[model samples]
Target: MPRNRQILLDNRPHGEASTTNFRLIAEDTPPLRDGQVLVRHHFLSLDPYMRGRMNEGKSYAQPQPLGQVMIGGTVGEVVESRHPKYQPGDKVQGMGGWQEYSVVDAGQPGALRKVDTTHVPISHYLGAVGMPGVTAWYGLVKIIDPKPGQTVVVSAASGAVGSAVGVLAKARGARAVGVAGGPAKCRYVTDELGFDACVDYKQHRDATSLAGALKEACPGGVDGYFENVGGLVLDAVMLRANAFARIAMCGMIAGYEGHPIPMQHPQLILTNRMRVEGFIVSEHLEVWPDALKELGELVGSGKLRPRETIARGLESAPEAFLGMLRGRNFGKQLVQLV
Candidate 1:
C-alpha cells in the first residue's frame, strides 16, 4: 500500500487561523473498491470560504469537521481508476481536499469531471475558468446586471472574484471601477485588468477619503456594485450608489476573522431602494455550464487575465492559506503539488 499524505484541521483557531490549527497526516492508502479512482492532486485552491469553514458557527456550508482532512477544491490527474468511466492519465477536478492524493468514489454523483489541459491550463480549473470565475459571472449577470454606460464598482478589486467582476463588467460595456488595498494592486486592477479606474483603499482609510475617491472615479454615481471586501468599502459604496442600484454581496473578508467591523451607512440600502443580495456560488450549480463556457472563452481569447500567487509543494498550503487571509497575495492563491 502506498502512503498518502493529508492535511487535517487540528483545532479551531481562537481568532485567525494559524498553521497550528492544521496537522499533516501521512498514512498508507487502502486499496480502492469498485467505482473508485485514485487521484493525485496537482494543485489545491486556497479561498476565503475555507476561513469560514474553520469556524464553529451557523453558515451556508457546514463547518469543516474537526480533526479531519481539510476541505478544498483540487485539480488532479487520475493515476489509477477502478471505475468504468475514468481512465489513467485523465486530468480531473474535484473536492480532493488538501492532500497529495485522494481516492474519489465515482459512485457519488459529480465526484469528478475530466479536464482539457491542452488549450486551458489545468490549474485554471481551480481559478479563472473554475469556481471564482463562475462566482463573478453569477453575481454580475444574475444579480447586478449592469448596462452599458452604467458604472459598476468592485471591492477587493485585485483579488480573484473582484478582478473577474471588473473585467466582465467592462466587457459588457459597463464602466468598471475598482477598490483595492494598495497602489500596486490598484494599478494592476486598472492598468492590467482594464478597469476604468481603481481606488486604492489603503491610501484612504477614512470614509471621507474613500467617498471622495469613489466620487472622482464614478462621477455619475455607482449603478452596480460587486462586493467582496465588505467593511468600510461597502459603506462607501452604499452611500455613493445611485437610485435603484443593485449590489451582489459575495464574501465579507473584513469579518471573516472574529472581529468587529462597523458599517457606517447601511441605512442607504433602504433609502436608495437598492437591491442587495448575498449568494453562495455552490448553491447555484445551474448557471455553471454557461458561465464556465463564457469564462473559458474569455480566458482563451486572452481577454480575461487572472493572476495567481502560486506556492510550491503541499507543505506550503498552510502558510500560503494564512498569507492570503492577511491580503498578502494578489489574485487567486494556489498551492501546486506534484
Candidate 2:
C-alpha cells in the first residue's frame, strides 16, 4: 500500500471560497478488493462548476460534502488492479477527485475509462478531449447550431470551454467572435484561436459600453451565443443579437459566489425571438461518442490546440482553483499531482 494525499472540503464557503475551505490530509492506501483498481493520479482538473457544488443548496448536482475528498476530474495510470479487464500501466480517466491516488470499483459503469495517450496527452483527457470539449460540442452543435456566415459569440473566450466553442463554431463555417477579460486574452482568442474578432470586456464598465464593442466585432448581429460568464456579458450579447438567435446557457460564473446577476432587459428574449436553452452535458450521454470522436479528431489533427496552466503538486490545488475562479489562470487550470 502507498501513501495517498487528498484535499477534502473542510467547510462550505460563507461568501467566496478560500484555501481555508480545503484541508489536505495523507492516508495509507487500502488494499484493492476484487474488481477494483488503484490509480496514481497525474493530473486534477479545476472547473467553475465545482464552485456551485461547494454550496449547501439545491443545484444541478449534489453539494460537495464537508470533510470529504473534493470532487473533480482526473487522469492517471493504473498501478495495481484486481479487475480482470484492467492491467497495470493502463492510462485511465475518471472522477478521481482532488487526490494523488484513487481506488476505483472497475465493475461500475463509467467509473474508469482507459485512454489512448499515444497522440493526445493524458492530461488532455481532463480538458479539451474530455468534459470541457464535450461541453463545447453540446452547447454549440446541439443548442446554438450556427449556420455558415452567421456570427457566433462566446464569453470567457480564452478559458477551456469557451475557447473550444469558438473554434468549433468556426469549423462550421460561422464567424466566431469572443469576449474575454484582458487585451492579451482577447488577442489570443483572435490571433491564436482564430476567432473572427474579440472584445476586451475589461475595457467596458457597463453592458451598453460592452454592447458597443460587440457591435464593432460582430458586424453581423450575433446569430448564436455561448453563455459562460453571464451578468453584463449576457446583457451585451442580447443587445447585439439578431432575430431568432439561439443562446446556449452553459454557466453563469459571474454569479457563482452568491451574487445576483440581473438581466437588464428580460424582454429581449421575447423581442428578439431567441431560443435560450440551459443544459447539463452529463444528462446528454447519448452524444458523448459522436462529440468525443469529432473533438478527438480536432486535437489529433492540430486543429484544436488547447493551452493549459498547471500548478505543481497536490498542495497547490486550492490556490490554483482560487486563481481560476478569479480569472487569473491563462487557459485550462490543472494540478500536476505527479
Best by lDDT: 2
Candidate 2 regions with alpha-carbon error over 4 angstroms: none
TM-score of each: 0.98, 0.99
- Candidate 2 lDDT: 0.94
Of candidate 1, the 10-residue stretch with the lowest lDDT total is 200-209
Q: Give the per-residue lDDT digits (tens) of candidate 2, residues 189-271.
A: 98888999999999999999999998999888999999999999999999999999999999999999999999998799999
Q: What local lDDT does model 2 show for residue 138?
A: 100
For model 1, how many clashes?
A: 0
* Residue pairs with clashing backbones, model 1: none
Candidate 2 least-lDDT 10 residues:
298-307
How many clashing residue pairs appear in each of the predictions shown?
A: 0, 0
Off by over 4 Å in 1: none
- The sequence of per-residue lDDT tens digits that candidate 1 reaches over residues 1-338 is 46888999999999878999999989987798998999999999999999999999999989999989999999998889999999999999999999999999987977898888877899888998899999999999999999999999999888888888988998899999999888889889988889999998888778877898899999999999998988788888887899999999898998999897788887888899999999999889999999999888888887788889999988899999999999999899999998
